[model samples]
Target: MQVKDKVVIVTGAGSGIGRATALHFAHFGAKVVVSDIDLEKAQKVADEIVTNFGESLPIKANVAQYEEVENLIQHTVTAFGRLDVMVNNAGIGPKQLLKTAEHTLEDWEAVIAVNQTGVFYGMKLALQQMLKQGSGNIVNVASLAGLKASINNLSYSASKFAVVGMTKSAALEYAKTGIRINAVCPGYTESALLDKLLSARPDMDTMLKSIIPMKRYGDAKEIADAIVWLASDQTKFMTGQTLILDGGTSL
Candidate 1:
């Protein structure tokens, strides 16, 4: 948990929160494994980590696919000798799934596959490795929507809610196994996904600001900082907790 020379794996590291977190871990002296569905993007991040801090590996893994995720963990352990931290940050929110009743089955399935099932897979595989070693840390990324219902994000909310539940349940199950599991619920943040949504809706900026007491969107680095703390020795006494970084939006 010192992070110095620790082995950390971050999924969805192509861009946004995942990318920021992968770099953050590297900056803190962790040997990071950067994974993304896009190999080029993952490799780019891993390359940057090495270029800056000198230890990283890039692997292509679609969290939604069990084989890819399994391979990702196996490769990391095989290469790093032990997995110290697991950040299950891969997720998706289909823009068109904003309509509660009008969204397609495909959209719901897709969101659940990546957002819900993906987190589950990451936790399970990471727990397996941690059990073998008798210790580890895991952080699953949920959302403010996961903590509370949103107006027009049905599929996304449902999947994220599942993540919140999964995090709590798994954390309790492994509470005595030396493996700690926790969740981070990030509110509306400056992410590529949000940028796309804002581009589509002209009035989104004002609408979003009005809802958040902070009157601003969160930066990706802010969320990454929270994740690093959660995965570090600083939180050794904590587990099954959900850290809400929503800028008081939930209030």
Candidate 2:
């Protein structure tokens, strides 16, 4: 599917996979709305896109908040005149060892609020606009953890699993409305978050790489390509599906 002239919104666009996706979409002639909690970082990404001769608007928003998400959609429509795609990619995965039954409830709630509730709010608002337009696409970024269980982080895994379920259910509900909803579940990817994890547990990095059949980590751009395609016409017939990018880890 051609990305030319498409108006796409990418949440958590300040860094990592979100940043990569936003830049890639802009390079493909899409008008991008880059949203992040870090306004400065989001603006920097927007400026970089503009410097590269692409159109982009950076807005500060916490996807966990419904009001902020509503404003994000409103601002994008106000700026681009229409909304074609919404990428629900903003999420956090702070390492939380569940070895102790005394894990902080606050941490658990925070993860679920952002990773699961955030995606729900995004889909809700995006669907509202898309229903009005009669056509749209929603590409949710889940994780390999969504499909499998995580021994170390129970909350993160549960939240992601919820995302997988939500994506499928929403896709089925909106398929006849010309709105396709799908998810991309990525395995260990090379990103700033991974670097932090490696620093904390140096040996775990090698262990993770060996677990993937390819014996390597994925690049952010590789995930971005899958998301862009899922958001385009190439996947018009596809919905209610979870496209895995795990390098055969799940196989």
Candidate 3:
């Protein structure tokens, strides 16, 4: 709960919120494991942590694949001796936003694989390790879209909704097992994902910012701070809940 010396694994640590979370954990003195589909990016983040005098290990694993996730966990334990916190933060969105009826099966499947099923795999595999240790914590990254509807992001919205459900249900099931599960729903953050979406629909930029009362996008470090708090003793009694950081957009 203190996070100091705790062993934490952050998926998708190659960039964006995932990268920030990994760096944040290491800054708090946790032994961090940086896992990402891209080894180069993962290693770079890990190296940054080490350079800052914090501890970290970089491991490449695609959360969509069961074997890769399993290997990620095994490698973490082999290096750190135990898994204390698991951040299921890896996710992906559709290439292009389209009408529900216009979306292809490939689009749906690809998003579900990485966004929905990927969380399932991370939770399932992480829970196994946590149960073995008799106690641990999980911080899932959902989205504002998960709680409400995103105009043209059908598959992404659906996958995120599933993540919210999974986090709550699993938290309830494991409440008494010393393993706490919670989720963070961030909205319109300044990240590569947002850049990609904006690149596809540049016109939506103004509309997106106008909806949020803050009139600005969130910083990745702010979300990372919230995640680290959720995984700490400050929120020890909290589980099966979502901490929304959407700059009042959800309001």
- What is the alpha-carbon lDDT for the whole of candidate 2? 0.91
Q: Which stretches of candidate 1 lie over 4 Å from their true place?
A: none
Q: Each prediction's Cα lDDT score?
A: 0.91, 0.91, 0.93
lDDT of 2 by residue, 1-251 (tens): 47889999999999999999999899888999999999999999999999995899999999989999999999999998889999999988756565437556876888888999999999999999999999999999999999997777778788899999999999989989999999999999987767877888899988998899999999999999999999888778999899999888998
Give the top-scoring candidate (TM-score).
3
User: Which numbered prediction scores highest in lDDT against the true structure?
Assistant: 3
Flag the better candidate by TM-score, 1 or 3: 3
Which of candidates 1 and 3 reaches a greater lDDT? 3
Error of 3 at 88 (Å): 0.5
Better of 1 and 2 by TM-score: 1
lDDT of 3 at 223: 97
Order of models, best lDDT first: 3, 1, 2
How many steric clashes between backbone atoms does each model show? 0, 0, 0
Q: Give a tens-digit lDDT track for model 1, residues 65-111.
A: 99999999999999999999999999888757357778778888898
- Each prediction's RMSD over C-alphas, in Å, is 1.1, 1.2, 0.9
Error of 3 at 135 (Å): 0.4
Off by over 4 Å in 2: none
